[model samples]
Target: MRKYLILGILLLGSMFSYANVSIRSMETELVAVGISHESIKEAENILNIALKKHRIMLIELEQKELEVNKLLIEDPEKNWFQINRLLDEIGQINANIKKNQLKAQIDVRKFISKDDFLKAIELHQMNLGVIK
Candidate 1:
């Protein structure tokens, strides 16, 4: 019984880990769109630099959320007030992640043609279907 419980926990953890990928897959999408390898490398390099700040913020956000969850679990009554604040923080983090993603998209687009960008979008949609 304990082994089964541990397996279930590990499976769920792996699922969540896959859910968080954004940048790496996008790079592959670039290659799928027939983007030049040199261009992809250059664009990815620039985008990666731009993403470092946003990535740090996201990491901090994740840490804070985990801490908040831990607090709520350990002491439900006292942690009630923290819920609203944490929710707000989470909302802000989500918005910032979106913003950063948009910025990265634009940065990569600058290195590729408009047609390639459109192709990438189509490929991304197809990948969503296939991945699920």
Candidate 2:
């Protein structure tokens, strides 16, 4: 979880730095590409909900990280047990975040056809410099 969390946070943090993409922009592109309005709307709704959940979880994680950091700073060598308990809480929070993110992706996919998904991926790659 720690390994993935490192990667995930890095990706999430740097995502906006790489592109000005938003769910609304994707919705517009989907509509422009002839995807049905209803399908695009549904997908956008799912994405928005997922993003909100992800944001909340990120804030929670940051708060928990601060608590852990403070504990380490205050006790340094005498809070091993409390530090472990905080680590367990962090683990649980990360698991919940992973679950919510996956569920959101699953729900979004239900409304987007395979070709549309591919197009979105391609656009993402182009915007994020994955493809030059």
On lDDT, the leading prediction is: 2
lDDT (C-alpha, whole model) for all candidates: 0.65, 0.71
Q: Assess candidate 1 and give its lDDT.
A: 0.65
lDDT of 1 by residue, 11-79 (tens): 533433332343356667768878877887777576666557555765766676777778778896888
Pairs clashing in candidate 1? Answer: none
* lDDT score, candidate 1, position 56: 72
- What stretches of model 1 exceed 4 Å from their correct place? 1-42, 117-132
Scanning candidate 2 in windows of ten residues, the lowest lDDT window is 13-22
Residue 77 lDDT (model 1): 80
Please write out the lDDT profile of model 2 over residues 55-81, one tens digit for every residue: 777888878878888988999678888
Stretches of candidate 2 off by over 4 Å are 1-7, 13-23, 26-29, 32-34, 120-132
